[model samples]
Target chain A: MPVDHKRINGPENTIPYKLYTKLNVKSFKEALQDAVKNGVRNDKRKLDEHRRIFMKTDIVSQAKGSAYIEIGNTKVVVSVFDPREIPNKNEYSLNGELYCEFKFAPFSCPKRRLHQQDAEEKQNSIVMKQALEPAVCRHEFPNFQVDVYALVLENDGSALSAAITCAGLALAQAGIPMFDIITSVTIGIQGDLKLLDPMLHEETLCYTSINKNSKTGKNSHGIVILSLLNTHQQVTEFYQVGSLDIDDIEECTKVLTEANKVVVPLVEKCLAKHVIKGVKESSQ
Target chain B: MTLSEAEKTFILHGVQENFRIDGRNRDDYRPMELETSIITHAFGSARLRLANTDVVVTVKVEIDVPFPDRPLEGKMEFFIDCSANATPDFEGRGGENLATEISNTLTAAYSSNSVFDYTKLCILKGRKCWKIYVDILILECGGNLYDAISIAVKAALWNTSIPLVKSVTIDGNNVDMNVSENLSDCIKLDISAAPLMVTLCKIGDHCVVDPTSAEEQCSQGAIVVAISKGKFSTVFQTGGGSLHPLTLMEKLKLGAKVGNRLEEALSEALSKIKENGEMGFLN
Candidate 1:
């Protein structure tokens, strides 16, 4: 009965586990070349095309405002609580606080997540907060803190972008004042192929490996996530993983900004629907 | 969530009269929506929504060495996470205490051999075994958390399919296991004896099952009874109020009866559930 040892509280084992058996695996360079030559991806989407997105707001009844976003297999739910007095606040401050906690459900990913938020999740939480900080009208609720909790129900890829986008919609649905709508998109780059909203497999295949043999040209295959304030045309936050050349980074940012433009209308439509439903209910 | 004295009196009188605030009888449960195999990555998963209280349970299995003391038994672990989205109070580590209490209660309820046969999970008896991780996420809190969690866990376990082991090679201190390659080659657990927990809250001398958050606040005391195959697997008193011996017996009886009915209904729903259908929070 190895049950007792399993019951003990300890840090989760961080060892990675492979979900699919590696068979007929194509090298990173070959995969990149195939995408560039054939103009098609494994999922059959064009290199610059994104997965279909499904967005809805006011899904969680308990939270003041909530939204559920599903982009292909990636599903994330974000809830925004009502603003409250900042805990541990002794002196008055003009800036309102934004608290974000991003978590992946224990069974959301290929690997089981621990009950506690891990380092990656904590970093994402901070990134999310920073992404939405400039968009929100903090001066309206000075000395108060608005809590945003994003839970990834399923993670295929581009989860952080989905969270940021979903959180912005949730805040708007919660009736929090904001300067403009915020939207985000993630771009995966491998060689000359640029994938918009790449699925988990494509993302891992493109970004996880770095070509060690390259000594002259750019060997950077990486991911770039950009949060944009659509109306104001401002880049609120930009997060990049892996090494990339200046040209590649510029191209990725341009593609990601374009993708964000496509997502903003969807977010606006969801918020409008929420507001319409609220008005109808009140009238009835 | 404070209730006025008037509200408490109304609830107390309603319970005594066998009619709850929401028009449900003493033993009546709230309408529940259950969906299974929701998480694609998990071996088994289920989401149960009893009114506003939502719980999702996922089962993950791994191979591990058997304990020296219980050489013939496998392992089953329960982890409960209280999502901050459920309530603002659960922010940071604020919900740790409640999460621990619920997980501990589930462990006790499933500890009985009759409730869940752990030996069935054993692979190489004494040497190696399959470790099952039952992770529960509380998405909302309406009330009767114990009952909702138990139902979700049972459904998740029922939906669980352990990968079929093809072969095992023992090489001195090392052992290797080969699992079947076919995706459908798996074993589904027999959950006929899985326990179902029922919470009976005593309000003004009368016990009521499936107490909502408001009724829970009005309850003087409550008993959580875990019933498996018409037998009590575990019983624990909750809340701060005390109960007399006679009252306790009465509440236990009510809990057992409700628990059995719940178990039957759950099995019936599970059997009716189609393998592939529209599921998850979308619907």
Candidate 2:
């Protein structure tokens, strides 16, 4: 839906959807079982399996630094160009030049469409930008914007998560120094059944449940989108379940671990392919 | 928009020779990138990019009393917001006028019955109907805003899901909508007739579909055609320059062909969208 401030009729729609999302899943346990069965094969490997990631540096001809990553059907092309000179003189961040845009072609989705960034996409872009900040060596680059434009032509799921991993890979690929990889995962809870890497269908079922009873209500399956740092895999950025309880948090943690099982390796594989071999991290 | 001599000359030269810097023929559109179901939060969402010009569209539905005049037909509205990142020119409210113009154009393009069936959104006669809000957020402007916005809006709509109201309680004036508890208890809008806008920009003696920002500045005039289900839903003119009747017809044919290709490609892409969680910036 196109968000128009002037039109009062539609904003209600956006707000209500976010709030009272009804559940499509029959039960949380059923959804979880379905996800596990559908996402991974009998052998335990993911069905639409993303391969081991590999990253390399200086791939962008015109960019100062760049990286390329492929995770199954998910592929990201990022270019860390010169720190964009922010023209607004009065405004400056001690963190240095920084800008990130996440984009997907209509061709990227199963259904094609025109190009327009909406609220969810915008939020995701900002989330990705934030997730990349600590992970990239922005101090070394300074005063210059690192343009990390992620293009997903094919989607298996977990886009922002992939983008975070991909951006880190790109930073390393560009030979831009970095601290750690910012890996992300999307975990969902139906009832007692918690799952990871919820795809479009699963998401639909998921939201139906979450939207219906947001609180400790019976059919609530809130989203648990989290960003993690690679050193021992700790949480850095989090937008976990909203208004849920401690028990729910525990359920989400289990799902998060399950997500990492699929995502962590993909990040490493991409890093291996794109990052330069001999550029040692400074230890001053 | 003001044009610089060097930029203008560069575009004019490319148009004169029937070639764009991106290597697209004057009549050829830039490679379009489209994704559907990208935004999990929204019931239906799609992102379309015509080269650097990008638009993200999300469709949200809600129950509301119908307009006094159009009670049977549900409401459909368009909202366009131009991001400052696209260009400094769009900073603050600078792009409001343009945004309004494009949104109005879109509304008009999709208003006709042939383009979109508004009655399908009606739940109760004059009581409640699905008010679909097409939120268009322009991230970048490479040119051809009309076509990009229109296509993205349509895609987002096609991806929209109106909650199947199992029942409704008429509590005097305060009515209550009983939403279906069944997860698959839903209805999908058949948007095959939804129109896709194709822009024809005139250059020298010929017209081109999907012009870049530079060429848009150089164009004397342009036309926007909204085609639905292989038929021309609506055709209107844009830009400062006007067009001859004969030339407009010729361009209309070209626009229709392009629209067909776009619709086919879009349908195929949309059909391929899996329930898998493969979305976001990193594909």
Candidate 3:
């Protein structure tokens, strides 16, 4: 059944996307308007340039590992549950581990979505699992699978980015040893500008620009999904530009390369504080 | 609550001694946390967490042709989704029954003219009208779901800013709407008469408001009373257990009293939202 966007009874949380409305297929007009409104400003920064960020772990006492990360208005809480045995073997992957869910709760949208899981949610879980695989040395914790749940409690834009950033923090909070801390950043291009951390409005109007024949726009309009290895301060896995081809891959590496530079120290700072807190708590 | 002997003894002793299960008196309400304007893209929305129960409500307004029979009346629909966040039992398609029941109750409660004036929502008789959609999401079920949902819905309605529709044109059967550009020129729904739900759980001979999950499991039955303007908008008696007419009447009285208090509290909360206000989940 087609989920009616307006009918879903969730929360009345308004996410500002109306700032990017297109009159027609000439989405360039809207993109240009947005570029003028948000892109041209001196505040418009590029990929690899990171915002001041912070994260904390063990905020939710009950959760196995819970952490909160903030990237401007994008605040997310990620929690990791101890690896549990699979309920149904039929659905299991090659590895014994299974079960991952990501959700922007009903109230997370301006127009509430039905709380039931949908294709978008399923796709997000896959992305989350893929980003997490490289960071989590799953071989040691075999026969069991950890549930990495990311809740976008507040989304300014770049939720996928926040999810990657927050997931590693949660794993660390849960005391799960990992090779590195993972951070993701989304970069969108509109004409002569590249916007770092495209807000909810920017992402919505992005597709319309692709509908137009702006090849250069397509190059910059690409998305870079990166997972950071905290110790190495490196990009372990990268997923980018599903719709665009090799030639159309406008801007590459800058977002992930930049994200690694900006995000590594922030993650380390949080981890150090968490370690100190754990020692203090155990002593108490 | 149809408590076992030991449980009954414990509760009675606690109530008499001024300490109930969650360590509070009979009249004590659960802690409430409310977050507003969180949904950045919605017309208006709010989340209310009363204890462990979480309710998220959003309001969306769309223009549509008014019903032929009710030419001057607009449309307002209430839909509730019993989400899995409440419990594992609500996973997948399992929560439909509870969701439908809650939505039906909300529909009935808001059916009265005094509760929500549909006529005011009309643009042109039989030509154009504003249909307000109120969507409710139940996240966690600590207890007192009805009360939390109702309060959140009311607050969301108050926060709703209906776009100021400019000069609606009707040509034969076709209707053309012109929307105003002024953001400040918006109509706010007057929800002073909006109904508040009071869930009265029958625990032995007494009835309790806002019963916990264990208390609910122990109860024989529960009655949902929707009160607006000090009048009964709807009374829904749910669960399998039956009660005598006299007992039902007594429960109705308790519901009425509780309903009044709820209405008062809701109005006070909504008014405070208009003034300098502060609330969130961190507390």
TM-score of each: 0.51, 0.49, 0.48
> Using TM-score as the measure, which candidate wins?
1
Q: Is 1 or 3 the stronger prediction by lDDT?
A: 1
Worst 10 residues of 3 chain A by lDDT: A241-250
Q: Rate residue A248 of model 2 by lDDT.
A: 57
Residues A1-284 of candidate 1 have per-residue lDDT tens digits of 01244454455544344423463246656655655557887778888888899999989999998999999999999999999999855668677878889999988987678767765686577568777887888889999999999999999999999999999999999989998998989888665667899888677755433453567644445667777887777666655554344456556766777888899889888888888998999999
Q: What share of the true interface contacts does candidate 3 keep?
A: 0.00
* Residue A275, candidate 1: alpha-carbon lDDT: 81
- Show model 3 residue runs off by greater than 4 Å: A1-284, B1-18, B274-283
How many residue-pair clashes does candidate 2 contain? 71
Query: What tens-digit string does per-residue lDDT give for candidate 3 at B194-249?
Result: 87888877666567788777667656567777766665555555543344434555
- Regions of candidate 1 where Cα sits further than 4 Å from its true position: A1-284, B278-283
Candidate 2, position A37, lDDT: 73
Per-residue alpha-carbon lDDT of candidate 2 for residues B1-283, written as tens digits (9 for 90 to 100): 5777887777777777878767888667778888888887788898999889999999888777786545578988888889898888888778875775577556655655445677888888878899988888999999998888877887788777778898878888877888987866678887887878888888878887888887887886676677766655444454534343335446767877888888888888778777544886677
Compute the lDDT of residue A25 as modeled in candidate 2: 21
Candidates sorted on lDDT, descending: 1, 3, 2
The 10 consecutive residues of candidate 2 chain A with the worst lDDT sum are A10-19
CAPRI quality of model 1: incorrect
Error of 3 at A203 (Å): 52
TM-score of 1: 0.51
Residues A1-284 of candidate 2 have per-residue lDDT tens digits of: 24455643322222113222344324545545655674563236563333444544456688766666555456666676665665544445444645677777666765443366543455556556656665665567555566677766566566667677767766666666766666667755555545465555554444433333256545434455666665635443444322233445545555564555566666676556443343343332
